[model samples]
Target: MKLGKSVNFTTILLLMFNMLLTSCGKNDDGSGPSPIPEPGDGVVYLPVVVHVVHNGEGLGEGPNLSEQQILRQIEILNEDYRRKLGTRGFNDHPDGGDAQIEFVLAKKTPDGEQTNGINRIDASQENVPDLGYNQNHYAQYAYWNPEAYINIWTTPLPESSMCLALGNATGPKTDLPGTEHLSIPGPNDADGIMINWIHFGESNIDCHARFGRTLTHEMGHFLGLLHTWGSGDCETNDYCDDTPPVDEHVYGNVPFVGCAGEEVMIGNYMNYSHDEVMNIFTNDQIQRMHYVLKHHPGRNALLTSPAL
Candidate 1:
């Protein structure tokens, strides 16, 4: 079912205003999220379906990564989200939070048939410049009900683009009013993360983003976390109080201090920093994600639906 545009717009504005007010308060030291949520709730499990699209390449070749590689990516996601001890980037920060979200590969299809959650498709539309269009085209080859499962498309992205991004995603549409039409089912339901195959797993390719943190970054977007700098300037907040506000994205290993002279959270998962240095989501980010999963339309169904 579609949402009324007017009602949706009003609701989103109200929610965003409330979030802004709630997140504006800072501690005496100028640290964020004045009052963080106490961690005691049960974990939220999300079923996942990975679509590996390749250019007629056989398994374990090109974009068609091995099943083991995909599993490794899932393991990385679990470690990042759950903050498992001994994981590469896990650390102890008072504001750093464990999202308490677990992602499991689907064991059953939408038709109730037992199968691995991985879908390998021999298609040539693997590399595209426009991520939204690419997801729509690839979904025609293989797609399940998006409401019940988190769909991740792994393919090669165009290397020639002037501005290269390891991955991109369509955040929850409920937050964008006029864009509700984009969520319609069929070939246009662009509601998942699209990652460059080379950046999918830790060992798939050797690049600056080889540590599998690209997916971690995109997953933050998928779960409604914006860049620490927000959409534009320091004035534009990401609705998280704990994160220091920067003027723009800080790429590579360059040290960045916030616009207001606060120490930037260079290691935040939402930043464009190198994978090895990117970790930790603030308490407010965790709260925002939990709110989306429980309150956003179509998203809430995943918590209860058995299909994937």
Candidate 2:
């Protein structure tokens, strides 16, 4: 079945970029963390478990990410979520409030065997190409409890240049069997996260920069962050009012200059460029994430559970 007007992928890319560049200039300094809508008391803290599957290829040029590399990446996410990137100027908003989400590599396999939470599956499955999808057996063998654990599968990304991250949502079928596939390369509600190995290498100014943030970016999608440019119009906002309206998408590596005197936030994580300048989430982005956790079907329960 055709998916709408088959938004020309290129067009969608440009549109997202333009919107980001144009909105970069607006800076209402002191745009603090969004007020928590739900009471801070009963809110639950979610634990995250990552299932890192690799092709045995090194991090940049060759070999899979060493255990150290994997751990480092996870640390980055933890830091980003905690609003602490080490350096004060590392993030644009400066107010990178805590995401309230935490990830710890699982120590026990689903079968209760000792595990680093990093499952090293032989990257040799016909259906599971180099791009990913070999996680079925891992999740099956490990047996994800579904309600308790969120499995994040990491694998060498496909050489395909067009698609960076692919996310699947279970919608109302969160309880369906195979929901874990959305996180791995499986079919059901797996909620898989895919990242290109190239993003960890030297970045090209003409193309988006290479950074482990691809995983971070895709994770945002898994958490339900719409492109920062807002799908369309200011009304189509990323569900955040602080983010400015973007008309065009950023392409190649051009530093987005703010439009109409607004301070350009080329550093926003949702933009297309690979610049390190875009790191913080607007208060609205944070709210949207919280909104998903509180209102989305399986998310809240899963997040609040200890199995995560």
Candidate 3:
């Protein structure tokens, strides 16, 4: 996408120079400068176990996503997070960087039993309630240790909604001072992500958001990245220096110049853009996620947890 017509040539030249310096760091071996970890240094593997909550729905029906569909979502997460080379959304933007994170299906349950990493539950609560589905109620069907596995509950939204949200996730609670204890694996109801079945895969549900980007966006929140527009306006910051601050969320692929005269990063995963348009994650965002993996009590455990 065109960033903007107002970019200064001198600034671009300076950026290029900085990149050259970064790529030419001194090395004792004299073989050459070490490759800078623009994306990151080491890969962080996260184990995921998806809980398919279906209300007596058979395979390939309703919220009961088939195993293949679930695997497809996992593949998308790995591709997007790693920014795999030649991927459809891959770009050469200087600020954009691979997150160096991969999601794998767990091979064992928390109780040291063999499993396929998928838990199927036929619960009535899988059906959306009149007041919208309750995450805690849905989680009752199947919930593993949140510290070791990313729990994803897929279900349908209430039928009476004015608008449909593909998914929602609970942001990391580590920021709360008194709530630090609650960050660890426990019986907390608000610990995992709840996704609309249609948006979980490349299905023919919501065309605008059917390409599995909803989970990618929600995962950003689970890892502590805020909306690119912060809470509301351009005045508030999402805490990432590379993500340009916008007056508000940019939906679809619309070009929007922020108050600071910089073009808004509509393609950022954290934005409300459509699946096809949302792709890049700024370097600052990668750094923030790494910090969460290293420091957050609830999330740090996943870094070393064995997928098996």
Best by lDDT: 3
lDDT of 2 by residue, 55-101 (tens): 55544333254566667767766665555757322464544545655
Put down candidate 1 lDDT per residue, 37-91, tens digits, no spaces. 2223668778889988887777887688899899999999989998888996586
Better of 1 and 2 by TM-score: 1
lDDT of 3 at 203: 69
lDDT of 1 at 179: 26
Runs in model 2 with CA error above 4 Å?
A: 1-45, 55-63, 88-96, 125-146, 157-189, 200-208, 251-263, 304-308
- Give me the candidate number with maximum TM-score: 3
Model 1 — TM-score against the truth?
A: 0.77
Evaluate model 3: give its lDDT.
0.76
lDDT per residue as tens, model 3, 1-308: 24357878887787789867866765766567654232246887788888887777788777777999999888888878988877645767899988888888898898888888888888764453343465576666777888889888887545333127677777665553222312233454547887877788776653688788889988888887887877556665687778888867678877689868999888899888988887799999898888777778778887666653
Q: Candidates 2 and 3: which is better by TM-score?
A: 3
Of candidates 2 and 1, the better by lDDT: 1
Error of 1 at 258 (Å): 1.3
Kindly indicate the candidate among 1 and 3 with the higher lDDT. 3
Give per-model TM-scores. Answer: 0.77, 0.63, 0.78
